[model samples]
Target: MKDFVSVIITAYNRQKYLGYALNSVLNQTLDKDKFEIVVITNFEFNKPNYKNIIDIYDNQEYLGEKIYKGLHESKGDIICLLDDDDMYREDKLERVTSFFKTFYPIYYHNNFVTIDDKGNEIKIIEEYLKIPPYASFNLPEFTLAIENNRKTDIRNLLKLNVNFNSSSICVRREILENNAQYLRKIKAVIDSFIFYSSLLLEGNILLDPARLTYYRIHTLQTSSGNTKNIKEYKDSFSNLFKKAVEDFYIITEMLNGKINENILEIVNEELLRYKLLYKIFSGNNILIKTKFNIHLLNYYLLSLLPTFLGNLYIKDQYNRTKKVRSFQVKSSNIF
Candidate 1:
């Protein structure tokens, strides 16, 4: 029997374009005998054109849980994930199958695609990444990229970051089994977290240069999902910032003493970013009213304003960001 490659999709009420995603997998250049696709849904799957497909039902309110369950249930030698609204290239599985056949462990690839919503193509979100002058060789390049805050890497990946777009990754089954317990801890989009965790465990992650995937940019995306309404702005930013803080601590712990200097620099930047984000949320009157008491109100403002202003200064070090530059010029030069 040939080694099986599993393609898993986690979706909720995305009936409009789920077929595009399913067809993308079915059309893969990889042999049908060698791979299978699993669609995990909260609703019953009624589509008849699915191939080698299995439906795993998850009633959880969060999409992450559905993914977790499907990932756990899959028994293929290699595994990949696709979101409901996204589609993959015809050669996606072929590229991944070849990579895993050789590497057989932790590996991810670069992703190139456009974001489209409401039948219109939006601006391209591309990056020109350059590794810092002084980065430690202790960790792999992909891990370094994630740590150093470089979202894209034209050369070797120093760390796992945006370069490992979830749709573009494939991994060995052993990794999932070995890290089964840790997978439960993930609640939000878990790809980034899993990539970082794999690096911490294996000390190396391979990246193929082939951009063999299409991550559809749709209106129902997680980022723009519930925050489109003006009324949800403050709460959205607040919850987002709080989640950032929690992720920071988790990553710091994951890195342990193995922390590389380049990674630490990025962590400091992220901390500052969250601090600034919290401050911005505090300044919003709508968020302030959600809580009671003058003490709590003052507490929110006191913690937020200074850090928010500070993060703006840190972000100004890069290219021409007007918001950060203006904030830097107005604030005291205490850096």
Candidate 2:
């Protein structure tokens, strides 16, 4: 039999889509008895005979806390994650288990497609993806990204994008058990914390390029729709970036060994543009924390940054940014 696996599906507010997600798990190509499905939620699950369901009452607001509780309840050595609104491919567990056997990665993230509330495929999210079973210390990109001295240069050259989907994350049981305290307090950013923490602990983190899950995108999921509103969207993303950077710093401090300080990586110049926006609007020196230079203008990802700045309300700052023209960018790198 395959090694026992636990699929921890968090059914928070999106119970409406829970059936589809559960169905996907139940219909896995792998043997059903090989894995247990642990549904973590605040509400009651009336489904009969599913012994793996656990109701978490307190710390109901943060998804991380619920996951922490789920970890304790799980009996599997190989842990898989799924959101209430997402679904896995039929062979997901089989493939993931196979990777665990072959690569022995402590952590795993599978590729996924972004879908709407109706399950219509919007776009395939391929964030900083690599081959199956890439260890952080072993991967050439990870080594180079940390070794680089300049912050902006590291941002530009390092292509290891960690676009983590909660449903796509799978890890060994010990990572969750060892970092119990960190996971409980992390709120919705739990996946990001686990990712960085695993990297810091020198755990083998596998980024499986196979699209094995469907990530749901719905309202309140406005981060996916950047084209809808100009200013509001940028603000939303800046707040996201702010949370992530702060979380990175927190992880670094908590795991304070000789961990690499490439933690404050900026995914795209667009996000940097918003960071610049905050400084310019708040009467703070724009270049105090950042030295936005020529290397940033190399990609096609953030050419829109300077153009967006050109349309700003502030005149002097706009003119200063106007001369700092030619901001190129690649695709938006998900952190």
- The candidate that achieves the highest lDDT relative to the unseen native structure: 2
Off by over 4 Å in 1: 1-3, 49-51, 103-105, 118-122, 125-164, 224-227, 232-237, 247-335
Model 2 worst lDDT run, 10 consecutive residues: 129-138
Residues 230-292, model 1: lDDT tens digits: 335345445655554555455556555664555554544444445444555535332221223
With a 3 Å backbone cut-off (N, CA, C), the pairs that clash in candidate 2 are 299-328, 299-329, 300-329, 301-329, 301-330, 302-329
Distance from true position, residue 328, model 1, in Å? Answer: 34
The sequence of per-residue lDDT tens digits that candidate 2 reaches over residues 1-335 is 23689988876655687788887887789976778888876666555355544444442756667888787877899888888878998999999888788777776777676566667665432221111101121112221212222223323222443334667788778777877777776644556566655554444656666778877665434223222344543454445444444454455555655354454433223334433434433323333254554544422232334543633533432233222221222244221
Which window of 10 residues has the lowest lDDT sum in candidate 1? 128-137
Instruction: Compute each candidate's TM-score over C-alphas.
Output: 0.66, 0.66
In order, what lDDT does every prediction score?
0.52, 0.57
Q: After superposition, how far is residue 208 of candidate 1 from its true place, in Å?
A: 3.1
